[model samples]
Target: MTASASESGNTVAAVDLGSNSFHMVVARLQGGELRVVDRIKTMVRLGEGVDARGRLDPAVRERALEALDRFGQRLRGLPRGSVRVVGTNTLRVMRDAQGFQAAAESALGHGVEVVSGVEEARLIYLGVAHSLGDDGQRRLVVDIGGGSTELIVGEGVMPLHMDSLEMGCVRLARQCFPKGRYTPRALDRAALRVAQELEPVARRYHNAHWAQAVGASGTVRAVQAVLKGLDLSPDAITLDGLLRLRECLTRAGRESSLDLPGLDADRRPVFAGGVMVLLGVFQGLGIQRMVASDGALREGVLHDLLGRMASRDVRDQAITAMMARYHVDAEQANRVSGTARHLFGQVRRAWGLDDEAEAWLRWAAETHEIGLDIAHGSYHRHGEYLARHSDLSGFSSQDQAVLAALIRCHRRKISRKALDAVPDNRRLRVERLIPLLRLATVLHRSRLDDALPAVALRRRDDRLDLRFPAGWLEAHPLTRADLAEESTALKRLGLALRVR
Candidate 1:
């Protein structure tokens, strides 16, 4: 749901559940700009908790819950939609992520969404781009996180190219320097590993020829600080300065004994790993110098939240793009969407649905036929597959799952198994929306400009009563026959559909 100005209270918050740290930023909207109000961060090191089985360790879960409890105190009493919480790489890989997400939500008192790597790169770019003053020249942004690194090239606020590599400070540190002993051999091997990961996209990023390079993330920030403290660069990170720092780090021998100026105690353990990753990036991408940005993923999420509250949501754009790409029949989509929205207005209160549900319904109605481009046979299944697995920006994993379920259930028999695939907490909500979408699609099956009759709908428990203008059904025999079949299909799912 998009929050309006009044509902937003001119206050907003964003939480980033990163692999190594959990960060929360609270900002106030004033004069059409976000002003930082408060910030909190914790070194959760969530990536360390995942075992070979992909299960989050119980101790690690407790630590995360405890940290969230602290963050929850500051977030208390904020209206829903005023705050957005997102999880990054670790949560994306966990096998039992659903159970962990539920517990985390309970502790934080807000919904948690897991985003794709590409989406993560986009948000990071947005945050970094917004932090710097506008410059017409193209810029390259790099973010080295605990479990992944994102590289984005863009001009101004719009990102043109984004790629995420699966190498990070935490993962690399654990793999090469597990005991905090950073031997030259281990550092060389780590750098070599990162180079291999970047091989596929190195040429493209180098060829983009961005006028300037910017870095965003704790790793990059620390690197800039160390260089400045040592009077190496005095400003930004240069290739020469990084080479000097790398020499110092390798000679320090162990993370515990390293006494580098401007290095934070919390950052020391991961310093070598982060430095090696940056070294690899600079070497592979042919970057000469890079400056650090004050913003990161949490800041990007806040800006995105502001956009949604102001009704300029990117999700709407993503849906429109998908529709155009699939060659959806706009007229038919509009007909179905209009009918679905009209029906939704009548029964939303009874079904306990809000604007968010309405948004999903409208998107589902518009893109329901996306799979027809592939083949007309079982197009619903094809649409479901695309929606579920595609790297759709501005949408969380949960949002995609719900969308896939709605499209899957739009035609043919509404399978119990299909509904069960939706998140447990959201199953009932999708169940309620399925019938409305089905009825709307059936009403517009002829794909003509024919106007639909005024229809009234009511809900009581699991039963639905649909009332059309008198004699309207008799005038539309095909629609009447479709409704008869729909009624029987709904009955199998224990929903009584009574039409008059």
Candidate 2:
């Protein structure tokens, strides 16, 4: 398909649910650049006090929802594709995230994507790199959030190496300075913890690998503010400056005593923890100097959404990469994909499907055979596993879940269990998509290059009727039998398929 950049509206919004704060950026997409018209940031500290079982404290959950309710108001009437909302470390670690996600989506009136750590790192790098443009120089990007820290090594807009460390401002603060004290001992312990987190990936990210370093997100920016605010490191972020800041913070004794000029009051409690994490990066990575970027994840999201509108989606790249990795049959996959797209166009309007659903159907058709590499027996299950677990860049956990569910139901007896993998809100439409994918694969079961006869597909409430060229099914007896069995199989999914 030809790529199209035209979208419903030029205005787009990105909401970032960071561990420490929630931020929203509304921008106008013009000539491939983002012009910010409105911005919102609220400190809800969503990462604080998350239990081991991945449950947030009730008060913290309430606080997060309240903040999202306000964000939803601003985003109330925006077109679906015009806004992108993502949750980072806090949501990622939340085991029962779907429960909270349901409430959060209700308040926001939009779906929330819980992105993987590496994906978050990629978005962070995208945000930081866009501001710098493509300098053709390798650089290190660091973003400190409330629950995790992302470090990316990249040249221009692409990230070559990325890692999301478990250490974050809010998590570390509660661990080392529960009472908000910044004593030397507590600070040393926090520093040690940060060093340990970086130990595994420090070699690839050290100063020797990058031309320059850039800091991003709230924590690093807060540190920048304090350093300049206090005249400690008026011109640059240096280890020396960090050392002096640490001294000042330690001398102050506690968060309440902190009097840094550039630090926001809301950031005070977690400031010490953020500082320690950044300081450790400076030391561990041997970063001599660093600069800050105004852009972060939300900006990256807007850029990504813009790409999606333009049909330059990075997720498509991810799908292609995955197909290549799994040794997918390009020819056969194309045959199925073309057929699926053809059928989707037939029933899209009748069934109320949209571009997103069409995209998912096409992806499922293309990669349905990814599991054949694992084993010829029940390859569908293997494909489903890989789809669910593999870190396909640009896909949220829920996105992966939906894609996996589609892959799972692409063949064999459709099961309620497989459809259950999809989130509740989307299950109904996906129920509609499953049969299309199954039918497409069934029609292409021969895996030949021969052209298929035109098939007219119509949706009538709960039943789908497919009419082929006169006597096409009689000439293709194998397909006739496959369709006969397919009809019975789809009955498990409560759908009636009629082939003529």
Candidate 3:
């Protein structure tokens, strides 16, 4: 979709392929202000079909495809870079998302990015922050979607802490009330499950308390609507309203027979389950009131895109943070990052790489030696663990996974089993970059004051040739030993690494 530079000139669209609902926002920018021209939402509940093995069922795919077709038609006139499409929790779970993403991109006439959960939380907070009119006070924002729940607290436009939990409306509904019956026992179980999931974050969230509570996404909207419909309050949801909603649901029992004017028909099926989870949230955290906001992931995406266009990419910050946290030698990191980037630039086009890969290489170089903190014995594994589990503030879940995998495989055996950890869609790209990282890491092993010898990179099928100055390896025996070991590892991955 083409985003017009002018409100009358052209339009930019943001499509949120959420687990519970697929949402699209068509808007035009006028004097740096966004005037929303069109908004579309359809409850697709993509999470409903995700099984234990993390596969998206055929039925869910069909529904999502059909919905995207409609959204695509609406986006036909938007400019190429004007439209941003993102998939949330369910998309993250899909092991075979390549096919789904390709089809969705074709239907929408735009690229679809399946972002990580932390990224999802970040966007949710941005949307909430913007919708709240730049409130200076730090506030907690909660977004409970069909497949995941995002909690974020931030002051102004920046989120200080963000977390995306696995619990969500659709997943909870399927797990707790598969028959679509809202029995008291079922409701209680669902609420308890949510409570259990929140336990990890509850104390910290409560202690790092916000002055106000802001809710986002369909569940929050539904709760606010029901409260208003009952003439309780239009401003925020109350404990009494929650209790009333739960009682009403328990009385109704069957989803089909339930009648609630405030709830939409598409939302009705999972409404009771979502309410149970929210009610648990209220009780678990001693929350008395919360104001729902219309802004969410989509708004966050637009704001982030703007930030990127303005050259303030958060991923850059993330790289810096990782380097500092891992206590990396700044000068050496810069040297490696520079060299890796140089090699990446030379081969990116030939290898079908892009900016994202470039960023990945930079980040991997920054933290490649993090394992040195632990015993240097297999520091690569230590680095991998740190990258994988560290509360990397700015990175999405997918980004972390990729970075961690690169760190893990940067050294050692380069086994096919190591690459198996990452998703199949990303495996090939990681494999292509691993040899370059290894070669760069080996060249920088000395970390000396003298200028390094010039190096050239050549690729032949799966093999790579690193031709250094004549006799450079002979002059540096330690470098020679490292290269000798690295060559053995590369050989296992069906690639030959030669050093001159």
Clashing residue pairs found in predicted model 3: 1-78, 1-79, 2-78, 2-79, 3-79, 4-10, 4-11, 116-397
lDDT of every model, 2 decimals: 0.89, 0.88, 0.81
lDDT of 3 by residue, 361-446 (tens): 88898888888878689988888888877766446555577888889988877646557666556777887788778877777777
For model 2, the superposed segments whose C-alpha errors exceed 4 Å read 1-8
Task: Write the residue-wise lDDT of candidate 2 on 1-500 in tens digits.
Answer: 11124433678989999999999988877786788878989999988848777877999889889998888887776777888899999888887888999999899888899999999999989988898898799999999899999999999899999999999999999889999888889999999999999999999898889999999988878888888988877766888999888898889999889898898889998999998999999999999899999889999998888899889999999999999999999998999888888999999999889988888888888789999999989999999999999978899988888888888888887757777778898898788888888888989888888888889999888788999999898998999998998899888777788988
Best by TM-score: 1
Which has the better TM-score: candidate 2, or candidate 3? 2
Ranking by lDDT: 1, 2, 3
On TM-score, who's better, 1 or 3?
1
lDDT of 1 by residue, 42-65 (tens): 998898788767898899999999
The Cα error of candidate 2 at residue 351, in Å, is 0.7
Could you give me the TM-score of model 3 versus the true structure?
0.86
User: On lDDT, who's better, 2 or 3?
Assistant: 2
Error of 2 at 107 (Å): 2.1
Instruction: Name the lDDT of candidate 3.
Output: 0.81
